[model samples]
Target: MFSFLDKFSSPVKAMLILTFFGIIGSALVAVSYTVTKAQIAANERAVLTHHLAVLVPDNLHDNDLLSDSLQVTDAQALGIAEPVTVYRARYQGLPVAIILNVVAPDGYSGKIYLLVAIAYDGTLLGVRVVSHQETPGLGDGIEERHSNWILSFAGKSLINPLENDWKVKRDGGVFDQFSGATITPRAVVKAVHHALQYYWEQRERLFL
Candidate 1:
């Protein structure tokens, strides 16, 4: 006494229903992501633009970040594995500052990424750590807050690294070291020293 409708009520029908719902759900997710992608991209661009502004002087105007020439190979030659971007911050079409990426591969835990902007004569306009893996509380002073140690890096030059003049005070350098964290400042000093050298060596390529 099999009923014809019993076949339609079987697991196959349930599977079909489930499959249909899955397809619809996936399509909805895909559409939602596609629609929101532009907004997400715009937000990311805004963040980058803001960070770039911190490097440029307030008096300057007409800054175009994208127009600045970028070179990946030159960065690689200098031991930077990641793509490094260079921005020419101009005041009335005259170069005023140079914003570039610096990589500190010898960080205590891992690599530390930095954005450094310097005037043509080598005055450090600003230095911001874009990314890092140092100890959460102990080594994070490199940022703008916990400690103003990073500020000391400004105005230093490659001509006088003063390794004796560029170390954490604990190590007898002019810069202050974290009370409980030595490696962090040590790594930062080395990175800044290397970055200054790299900047001088690449000035020709960067300016043009």
Candidate 2:
């Protein structure tokens, strides 16, 4: 008994129309998310793999470093405000090394983020400064290509460097500091030492 326009003008009919569209919109959003979720995860994994390879090297690890990641929350030990990710690398089902995400909070201008790779036997694989706000020419030498400064830490461990000799050259340690930049190197050295201390403490749980 109702006209088409009359039905549309009814409150119940209007409400029904709105509800129908809302359900359709929500279904579309769900479908879109389902379709894109795997790709997003893959992209993130690829990035993490590349970083792990840079610090630990591809041939050295047979297991998936991205899948073997753990989060540790020790602000004082890591020098960061938030938890840091640790990537474990293994060879032939045995632990080879671990890459620790570290932050040097006392850099010359600001914080310096680093990736430190250390073998299970306590050998230093490498130290990479991922991000820093240090001086362009001087403090930036902490970067591998900037100079051999970063490479100097490659073979060093707590035993090799000796705990008391972990400071910059100006502080009478074995590592060098840029001519005009001591604070940056000092902060990095301290952070590396702290990372070594942490690994020594958590080696058992970490390898498990």
Candidate 3:
């Protein structure tokens, strides 16, 4: 008749206990990671779907934007360290629009992230400020809820305003800058311009 620890010495019993618990802990961690990973991915998809819908109209695309996506690793142009994901919207087997995730590395306070929607013909459908840390009431005008300044970017493109006219009013551009917040708008304008440049360079691959 063997007791729980009868086959092992005192030291061996302690080692066995630790090993048992170690295995249990590792398994728990693996299980937790698997479940949490799936949840995180689902939440991310839902958020992307919402952003795409806001930028590209519902009737414009027939396929799933979340599934129809590609990644671009750009730092100097995009102002981001990680790979940027470009979501494509297709209509009736043809490319309709491409929504880009871009960052303005020179915002007043910090980076001003954006989701820019561009049509197949190089026209801007919409622009949404994803995140920013600019001063309240002043730099916040870039946000749609704060003011309509953001809407001014709609129907715009590289040639629409002319490349040189992409700057803020303070710098002699077509767009207006906030009374006391020039840096924020300036940064956003430059960023939007860069996004267009990127789309132009990758238009062939993007449409494919």
What stretches of model 2 exceed 4 Å from their correct place? Answer: 1-48
Best by TM-score: 1
lDDT of 3 by residue, 1-208 (tens): 2378788998988888888889999999999999999999898777667878989978998998878999988787787989998989999989999999999999989999999999998999989988799999899999988999999998999999998999988899999999988999999999999999989888889877
User: Model 2 over residues 1-208: C-alpha lDDT tens digits?
Assistant: 2354364657877777778789999999999998799888888667556767887878888888878889988898799979889999998989999999999999999999988999998888888887788889999999877888888888899898898899887899988888988999999999999999999998989888
TM-score rank, highest first? 1, 3, 2
Colliding pairs, model 2: none
Q: Which residue runs of candidate 1 sit more than 4 Å off their true CA positions? A: 1-9, 28-43, 74-79, 160-164
Residue 176 displacement in candidate 3 (angstroms): 0.8
Provide the global lDDT of candidate 3 against the true structure.
0.90
Clashing pairs in 1: 162-165, 162-166
Residue 26, candidate 2: Cα error in Å is 20
Candidate models: Cα lDDT each: 0.73, 0.87, 0.90
Tell me which of candidates 1 and 2 scores higher on TM-score: 1
- Candidate 1, residues 46-103, lDDT tens digits: the string is 7667777866756664667657747644443334765677778766777777877777
Lowest lDDT block of 10, candidate 3: 1-10
TM per model? 0.80, 0.77, 0.79
Which candidate comes out best when scored by lDDT? 3
